[model samples]
Target: MAHDSRTPSVPPVRTQKLRAAVSSRLWPIPVFAVAAAVALGVVLPALDQAYDERFPEVLQVYLFSGGASAARSVLEAISGSLITVTSLTFSLTVVTLQLASSQFSPRLLRTFTSDRFVHWTLALFLGTFSYSLTVLRSVRSGTDGGTEFVPDIAVTVAFLLAIASVIGLVLFLAHLTREIRVETMMRNVHTETAATIERVLARKPSPDTDAAAAAGSLSGPEALAAPDGQPVEAATSGFLTLIDEPGLAAVARDAGAVVRINACMGDSVIAGVPFATVWAGAGRFTAAELEDLSRRIGGTVTVGFERTNDQDPAFGFRQLADVGARALSPGTNDPTTAVHVIGHLSSLLCDLVERDLGDRTVQDSDGSVRAVLAGPGFGHFLSTAVSQIRHYGMQDVQVALRLLALFEEVSWCDRSGAQRHVLQAGLAELREGIGQHHYTSAEKQTLMERYQRAQAAVTAQRGRPIY
Candidate 1:
């Protein structure tokens, strides 16, 4: 059977991070608020003037006789309520974040921080406050008994926004409360990971394509050691999150070089470390050429402080695994939650088992290998998703049983020999760990039965005894 190996359809890590950074910034919301405020500031006066010209009598009646004084009272009240609601929103948000951090993984804080709903909600209230204050300053009383001026429509809109803010506050509180629940958190993470998997590993190659890829794979290593090749060092330090294979290939094709990336996604690298090795055929590159090549290569990969799920499936697995591990910790001691996480992890693994997990090799139009990127294999993801949970939750019978069941479930999938071997080895380790532990006779029997069932499934699949 052809190896089911394909690249994930994720954006380059740097691009993903850049998009995230731009979206996560507070300035976007404020910019929106300021723009809205400015538009209203300019338009409201014109609207008031239109109202005055259209219905002078109605406008006169609407404008408060006390003019600026009456408008100030109304504006002050609206601003005060807004300020109060803003403070309450901030307090509630902080409390929710603290709860999420303490109860769940701190990494999840990014989810809440980058939440567009929360940002827009805060912007709504703050925007109204700014609008009210701006219009309030425009309120003017008649001097020497001239006509009083009050932006009645603007004040009315501000009041309407305050009312909306109150309703938003209610909705925000409900959403925040729902968001903190373990079920909600787990579901969100699972959905994101599943989407990442679908986007990254969705493609299933045809038999001909697979055969061609297998043929191309053989030619990759031979192209690595070209004459006048030099190692290129990383310019920055962070976790390597993405490798833009096509872009790298294009650069390599233009430079007439074969580039081999030394680092894999989700790996931490140091500055001045060998990031990639380039083999330029026949000629040596000048200092400027090397510098430009390095810059282009650097653009192809993204290194960040924390691993993101955009292009790294392993990072998602790691997040879910961490959640399960934390739940299993003595202080938390929540096996049920851990079990829930394990079920999702198992589902992710099953999906992964059917998909391709292989290094991405990009070639030029001339069929020359230009860039080779290392990606996580099924073994790495399988281990990442379960190993920590197995180690931490080894003592729990339920957790152990679930882990065994996971292995059995994956064994039933149309997996490769390597995948089956990994599953079989996991089962053996589980059995050994169970035997070494001090389980009750009943618990041991229960685990042994599950382990045997898993072993039998693997044995039947492999046509030999796994034990």
Candidate 2:
């Protein structure tokens, strides 16, 4: 009959079987193992002796025989082996950790020393410990005089390997540190340039940002006539001057993305003519930021558009036209059209002196009295002659025209009467063309008066050639 039970019940047959198995093998198994080990140990030594006898020179022999010092010898050997192994393990662990953390390449590590050196060093330290242990054993057993032996060659070699590894790791770390500094500096420069350009385009110079840092001054508030007979918000026209001029070098360096040197004080820089090489340095700022730099630097500077590589619309020349356009006071005519016409006229007049000045070239390596002359018109003729006042607005423009004319008046001219007449004729032709169809009534009247005076001046200077 079978019975279902949750727990196991010991049966008579099972218990007897288990007892029989334990009694049969447990004691004999341990005894057999000990006997086998003893047999092997004894046989191995005898075999080694016989082999050495047959081939004495070829065999490397290590002997420990039963004697007064035999126990001490065995203990010393064990100690030495343990010490060498321990030293080797510790040295290897240290070197491996340093190599991984320091990021030194395998070849660089090779420049230190071979793995064999590490093993040798470890062996030496362990051998020293083993020698100490052996000496202690010898004293306890009363075998031989307690003496310790550690190989000097092994210990010295280990020390040298450790030193080399450390030096190599230090050098690698130093190189990485230097690389980080250079990269960081360049990044800062790039960021600054970009921010500068952005501020310029927005026409938003940060008084706050500027106040915090030491840089140039802010442009003064602009003034324009208002209907209330007071100054109101008006666009500044002409070559907007940069303040606290940092000179050309700063401009070229800080001008974001692309920078060019167009006009210098003496040399005429035209609106569109590109000059100088632009390269990456300062932060790649947007147009507004560059405008800020330009405002600080003082000059006819243009801040180009964001993302776009071409010149900005608010560029020097373009801004001048915009400002002039804004200043236009409309009568019964098309205000926008009038502004456009006036703006073009203003630009052309300003461009005249700039163009002529730009064209003049010095000749030769000797810096001799050679000159290349260019297009005509000094602001002087238009300023004093009434022609410019009718065509353009702004006191500044009138003043600039007068100064330009005065410069011409003071200069020496070599021209004959006939030559003067020919030049006057050319002037008349040019004036008529420039004043035709588009000029306001005031501009036309001014042109006529200026033409009459030009004829009279040539008549007076008949002997000199109009150059």
The lDDT per prediction is: 0.77, 0.33
- Tens digits of lDDT, candidate 2, 1-467: 11111111223333433443333222333344345434433444345434534644422232332443444454455455554555445655455535422431222222123233333334334433433442332233332564332222222222343344344335434533442332222232223323322422222124564252212111110111112111111123232222112233334333422233333221233333332223333334355654454444334233211111011112222222322333333422223332333333333333232121222221222222111122123333233223332344322323223322322232213132323443444455445544444555775566455455544544555332133
In terms of TM-score, how similar is model 2 to the real structure?
0.19
**lDDT, model 2, position 124:** 38
How many clashes would you count in candidate 1? 2
* Model 2 RMSD in angstroms: 36.5
TM-score of each: 0.88, 0.19
lDDT of 1 by residue, 1-467 (tens): 11124654566546776777856564578568867976796688668756755757755665444466877898899888887988898898888889888887887776677777788888888888888878887777777587777777777777777788889889898898888898888888888788878877745577788897778666543546555577788989999866666777878877877787877677888898887888775577788888889888887777888777677677778878888989998999999999999888888887887776766677665455677776777888888888889888989999998998788777766344447777777777778788778889999889888888888876665323354
Best by TM-score: 1
User: What is residue 359's positional error in candidate 1, in angstroms?
Assistant: 0.3
